[model samples]
Target: MAELANCPKCNALFMRGPATVCKDCVKREEEEFQTVYAFVRQRQNRTATVEDIVRGTGVEEHKIREFVRSKRLHPAQFPSLSYGCEKCGADIREGRLCSNCTEEIQNGIQQQDQLNDIQERNKKKDLGNATYYSMKRDKR
Candidate 1:
């Protein structure tokens, strides 16, 4: 089912379909894509980076990165084609983040989990320590 959405390019209201953008923007984008493709498809241009393509094709870097991320342009086939890591801004071929940032995030999560486990164990111990027993039975 198509949903109503604002086009990302022109901010126009449109029916959402397989594409995230509206029809008009899609047309423009297709032209831009073709321009970029033509520039990169040349033998000497096959290994062009995102910036180089943007300069050569007069296309936006974000759009080129978008194409790369969407697999419209394969990075493996074109070496030096990469986008920035979402966190560290380092060049990366795939995913939102580079390996270093991803590993750092995973390590941080593991540390947090360890801390949570320690806190839980401490809580359980405190509950055990808070227990009290009555000695009145000895008086009987």
Candidate 2:
């Protein structure tokens, strides 16, 4: 027989399989379902999509969507919920950036461009100086 592994939710011992969650955790999850449901039911929060709930509630997107599809969370409560835009592989629930990381990326790119331009200008100046020296040497 195979040995047991700890459950991810509650760390209870269970027969290991594809599932990381144990039965007791499953029961606890069921008991806590209403807590998730009630939070989504608020007027200001209602109509939030799965992505919105993930952002607002700090729940995993996949988990929240599964709950929504399972009728654990009411779809009627969140009619306005929509998936967040994929910005540089981040879950941007409210804005384009999950953080200011994209701006940092852009700033890095701009810095690189400035450095490249400076190098090109230096290379041209060197070439011009070399040409001036060669012409003077030729006249001598």
Candidate 3:
């Protein structure tokens, strides 16, 4: 379903559908993609990184990253093309985080879980050892 939306690039009012950007922005992006692709497909430039693509083609870094993320520019074909990991800003070709950051986060979660388990066990032990006694009072 197409709905009226403001173009993110040019801020023009347009109908939204499969494309998040308006038609003009889309066409402009397509031209930019072609320029970037042409630069990259050259023998010497085949191994160009995202930064190199931005510099060589004069395309925005974010747009090139989007191209890679969307697989409009396949990383497999262009070996040196990669985008920054969301967590650490390290170069990554696939997911949001690089392997090191992903592992670090996973390990942190595991350690936190272990600590929580230990705390729970300690609480249970303390409850079991707690003494509760009823006091008997003489009626006056």
Candidate 4:
């Protein structure tokens, strides 16, 4: 038996499947999907951020993510496809780097570590110098 569901848009009954839409609703959805797909498929738009898609199609980010999750939209098919970072919420396509920002963050940590090491060494040197002065004064 074919599973039946009411289209959320028109409340018409239809065979259940990937979309919660009737035949008529599906047609309309397909048209809208095509418009969104075409815009995202463009080379320049391929790497568009979440904001870009929302602005371009008036579609929600969650819906776009759903399309990607269901394989309705394949990122590999679109080379410029990308997503936001899990850690920092930055726009990223591959790995975790928004690139420039990642490098900047790493450099900052390295510099801070180096400064701390220098401070620690200076503190040790000061202790040694104070001990030496006290011993010489005691002998005088």
Best by lDDT: 3
Residue 129 CA displacement from its true place in model 1, Å: 2.6
lDDT of 4 by residue, 74-97 (tens): 778755445666567665556555
Q: Rank order by lDDT, top first?
A: 3, 1, 4, 2
Q: Write the per-residue lDDT of candidate 2 for residues 13-54, one digit (tens) a residue.
A: 898776568988777666556555766878877766666666
TM-score of 3: 0.85
Q: Where is model 4 more than 4 Å wrong at Cα?
A: 3-5, 15-20, 79-140
lDDT (0 to 1) per candidate: 0.90, 0.66, 0.91, 0.73
Flag the better candidate by TM-score, 3 or 4: 3
Backbone clashes in model 3, listed as residue pairs: none
lDDT (10s digit) by residue, model 3, range 55-124:
8889999989888888888899999988889988888899889999999999999999999999999999
Model 2: CA > 4 A from native: 1-11, 15-20, 81-140
Candidate 3 Cα outliers beyond 4 Å, as residue runs? 137-140
Which model is ahead, 2 or 3, in terms of TM-score? Answer: 3
lDDT of 3 at 71: 87
Instruction: lDDT for model 2, please.
Output: 0.66
**What's the lDDT for residue 121 in model 3?**
100
Question: Best by TM-score, which number?
Answer: 3
| Residue pairs with backbone atoms closer than 3 Å in model 1 (clashes) | none
